[model samples]
Target: MPKQPDPARRSERSRQAILDATRELVSEVGYAKVSIEAIAARAGVGKQTIYRWWRSKGAVVFDSFLALSDAGEGDLALPDTGDIEADLKAVMRATVAEFADPAFSAPIRALNMEIIGDPGLAAQYLEKLAGPLDEAKKARLRSAQQAGQIAPDADLDLALELLYAPLYQRWLLRSGPLTPEYADALVDLTLKALRPSARP
Candidate 1:
């Protein structure tokens, strides 16, 4: 007979199955329709098994997001080429493509709208997603500052806004497409506009 699986291995398999079920359900039905019972049924696991791991469906959704984010096919990190303009363009192009992907668009759009409508949930979402993304952008701006490519007096906070407001306006508001040329143009214009005068 085949040897019995270890307890840890079994636990790991169960967790992965639950997460996978959550992703599939979220993709099929919007977050509003995804439920713990549905996930348990889809995963082929007992409802109690899911309850043993997650207290609510939101936790399961968050776990699935973390899994998808870690896959690294998305715009998770900016390239550090010591040239801020090129790095920004590269990251922005990647962001546009990732945001445009069908697999990510619907769930993300729904999640963003839900977060905006619910204040309590918005706070949680900001802490989980927006806050980290902003901090990472600030770090990139600071790196450019140290390199003297951007102004020494550059406000990382404001610069962060300048860097993303156009893109966010496009992504969330659908005012325009975040094309490669648009991204490159934004970076070029930003460098020319924000750079310290040569006299200074």
Candidate 2:
């Protein structure tokens, strides 16, 4: 007897296809030029399929950004090598290199613009993407704190902002180069600020 296909598996495949199409269209034509009909055509699905899954083009684009960033894997943890400074420097340098890539930079910038313009989308982004990433980083910081590398009372959230805010600003404004040296410098400064004070 012939077996029937799993409807849920097929649906998931269609969902991934739509998200992939959204990413490609946005990268090729820019976010402002992408439309639901275009995404559907590119994905080999009907417009109704897209509409049924997403409330608007912005939502589809945001999901596409999430897909690209995560690669379908839910690995959000940062590396912890028992040397906080080294781990942080490695992560920051990788971030600088990623931002320097055109393929990554374009979609990331577009998604930032989309989030800035839409409050609802911004909230969703924070909750789904930024919040989880921040927590993972803070977990690393907490480990450092337990090891007495960082101040016991250090605010992990503030420490993270100190490390990353400047890099993000430079990238967003195109004001400075995103270089390994710059990333290392940021990590150095942040660590110095967060380091435990000398004891009596």
Candidate 3:
């Protein structure tokens, strides 16, 4: 008798295939045009398989984007070197690089445009994409506070916004270049604000 395939491996393969299909289709046809049926066909898996794993097209696409990030270089984890400024600068620089990358930039821009036109979709996008990144930054800020790098009473949510708002404005408005120097400047300014005041 022929050897049977491992159920776990088969499931993993199916999951990866679905994600890969989603990415390719989204890149080719844009997120608004991609559908579960098309993704299932491209993945060569039954439609029920995708529905079993993801509740909607947006959820599938979100997972696909995450998988792409994982395959490329893992998630956007902030570096913790104990030097808050240096760590923030490193992450911001990486963010600039991702924004400069065509593969990442184009799809993200498409999603941003979609969100601007649809309030409901905007909320979903924020929950799926921005929410995790914001939480991670807040956690890092809290760690810095504990280390005395940041003010004990700093509002972490506002502090996080200060770190990235300029970059976001530039990207959204297409008003200026998002260079590494710009990212460094944003980090420098944010660190100056967040750092505990020196004793007189």
Ranking by lDDT: 2, 3, 1
Q: Write one digit per residue (lDDT tens) for candidate 2, span 53-80.
A: 8888877876777676542366767888
lDDT of 2: 0.86
Instruction: Give the range of the ten consecutive residues with the poorest summed lDDT in model 3.
Output: 68-77
Q: Give the Cα-based TM-score of candidate 1 against the true structure.
A: 0.74
Candidate lDDT values, in order? 0.75, 0.86, 0.83
Q: TM-score for model 3?
A: 0.86
lDDT of 3 by residue, 59-143 (tens): 8887777665532344555778988888888888988777767787777677677778989877887787677778877888888
> What's the true lDDT of residue 55 in model 1?
70
- 2 or 3, greater by TM-score: 3
List the candidate 1 regions with Cα displacement exceeding 4 Å. Answer: 1-17, 27-29, 44-59, 69-77
Query: Which prediction has the highest TM-score against the true structure?
Result: 3
Backbone clash pairs for candidate 1 read none
**Backbone clashes under 3 angstroms, per model:** 0, 0, 0
TM-score for candidate 2, residues paired by index: 0.79
Best by lDDT: 2
Candidate 3, number of clashes = 0
Per-residue error for 108 in candidate 1, Å, reads 0.9
